[model samples]
Target: MQQPPSHAREILRLAVPAFGALIAEPLFLLADSAIVGHLGVAQLAGVGLASAVLHTAVGLMVFLAYSTTPAVARAMGHGQLGKALAAGRDGVWLALLLGIVLAVAGFWAAEPLVALMGAEGDVRSFAVDYLRWSMPGLVAMLLIFAGTGVLRGLQDTRTPLLVATAGFALNVVPNLWLVYGLGWSVAGSAAGTSVAQWAMASVYLVMVQRNAARHGISLWPDWSGIRAMTRVGSWLMLRTLSLRIAILATVFVVTGQGAVNLAAHQLAMTIFSFLAFALDALAIAAQALIGKELGASNSVRARQLTGTMIRWGAGFGVVTGTLLAVAAPWAGALFTSDAGVQSVLTYALWILAAGQPIAGYVFVLDGVLIGAGDAKYLALAGVANLAAYVPMLVAVA
Candidate 1:
């Protein structure tokens, strides 16, 4: 057998830290779900709907990280430190501007959005309250996303790992205090999360500022640079939005099935998302390494890195999938005791496990292409994928 690549160590260094950072947010949400679950099914359902909306909104702006990583990595790879820092700063500006717009829109549109999701009665009311209260946090989330991008581009995943770890640790105390100690219910969970998010964003801003000062880069926005970032970001946004639509469509279909189905789906999804952390970390490493190599005009090394990542991703997926399959018997017990929910979740876990290897390949390929700056093709592919998935969903429904 061929020996493993000598650079496997570098990939692990990046992937491990990136994985920690990636899992932080989901872990926070999982904590919230666990706490709110005891309050009753309606509240849990409410939190699920609100979370779906918040996730979709934030997911659409993930380009803040995705676009900045490649742009900054490419610039830095070419030894243009100043330009790299400048590009990162532009991403921050764009993130702030877009965050404000999205916060306001999502807040005001919360009720109708929930209604459109087929939520009703107490579920709708609770979802609206949670979503509206969480809007400010979305701003913090967007800022953190962009700042994390800047740090990743400079080849420093450790900082994000530290910050995310600290932030997530801080989240649990407030969540418990507000949700149980103070009796705020689902709204309290939202409040605690919002506070934690802003705290994380504040820390990230300080770090970014110090880095900028160290490099003698201006903190002020550059319209031209911002526009350039947006040019790439727009395509990413489209691709991201298309993915969200696919998820939203799935949620809609599940909702029509009834509250029990939706809740079970939510639990299964949470598990799937947690597993994605590993794949995502590898993908992130691929993005940074591939972008850096391509930026240095080392196409051959970039290809080699891509190949290595795909292999690792597949191997990791198989391992994770096996674990998921073994744990499937006990996975449902952790989320809920409801017979109906548990029944559905058992099968869902197996399905999710079986698909893990395919997911791993797709995730790795996606990051490689994104790092190659093939945003337009990715956008078109997302649309096509959605077009295909929708009909299948309809058929199943």
Candidate 2:
């Protein structure tokens, strides 16, 4: 039961692509921030606030990807290729259905939510445009995420990485054209992002099939397999659903504070998110390696692999966190010129960043637990976080 030295090395190599792809997403957001920065403080502030509303609303549906992967991976390990594909397809269906709901809500609900967040005249208009513009892209983005899960779960990282790289390029291209060349303003940027998402989704759909076929698997869903997948994946979906709701509640509290306050909080949260998502790929990495080891009946290997993931997650996420704190002012300035806004975000940035070390452990533990098929434990953990974070944020408000 001795740990293999290659386990850590193998995991790191496989994870590198996912980590790179994860980092690219925030970088794409930063591109928007950079584009809007020159527009004026209100535009930047408006974008930040609008982005938060969108993030919270659409982000809740991301459970489709998070919940789908382990089920697919586990099924694949059990020689249930058809079930693995069914799990993936069900995740896509969930994402599409959820996206339809969000799109409807986003189109109709944007103004009221903006007003509720105390968005003023210019800000309210910007938010309305941004949210409405981005609504159509949600399904595409979710599909891309689910597609990524399939690749990651199967330990095939290059496809997602390549697709993400292409998506990043897509973002840059349309953003340039819409924001600058066509002078479409914030609405154009949002539209451009949607375009990029579509590109990613399309590319991933094409790429995933080859990856699947390589393992003697098919990417299409089977009816019987779908039923089986749904039975098991429901709990995972619920576990992820609760966590997303908790995070959204936190954003709601921040939004309720005031637009200026919300803008600041959103910027800080965005900075933190960029780091978190980048490192969370390490968790995905851990899940894959752990599941692989468990399938191979190598418990000792799984433990060692999980430790390696923790080490890498801590090292990378912690450094990024520290640097984010140190550069908070400049980062804040990029998104806003309001001195009061800068003052609030500077502190929040550090506080959020400071938790990275702890979050690193939590992220790795989450992966290990998921890989071990300890979903009930995760359900309990999610419940605990929900109970605590909800009350804490409410009290702070």
> lDDT of each prediction vs. the true structure?
0.87, 0.73
Name the weakest run of 10 consecutive residues (lDDT summed) in model 1: 1-10
Cα lDDT tens digits, model 2, 1-397, are: 4446787668777778877777666776777877765665566667776787776655555545565667666766677766566567656655566678878888898788777766677767887787788888776877787787776767777778887788888897888789889998888888998888888887766665665576565555555754654555556666776776776566667666765676676667667777877777788887777776776677876777877777777787678778877887666777667777788988888788788888877887787787777877777777787887777777887
Q: After superposition, how far is residue 355 of candidate 1 from its true place, in Å?
A: 0.7
In model 2, the runs with Cα more than 4 Å from the true position are: 1-3, 79-83, 116-118, 209-233
Candidate 1 residue-wise lDDT, 52-156, digit = tens? 888899999999999999888898889999998888888888889999999999988999999999988888888898899899899999999999998888888
Winner by TM-score: 1
Candidate 1 lDDT? 0.87
**C-alpha root-mean-square deviation, each candidate:** 1.3, 3.0
Residue 133, candidate 1: how far off, in angstroms?
1.7
TM-score of each: 0.97, 0.87
Best by lDDT: 1
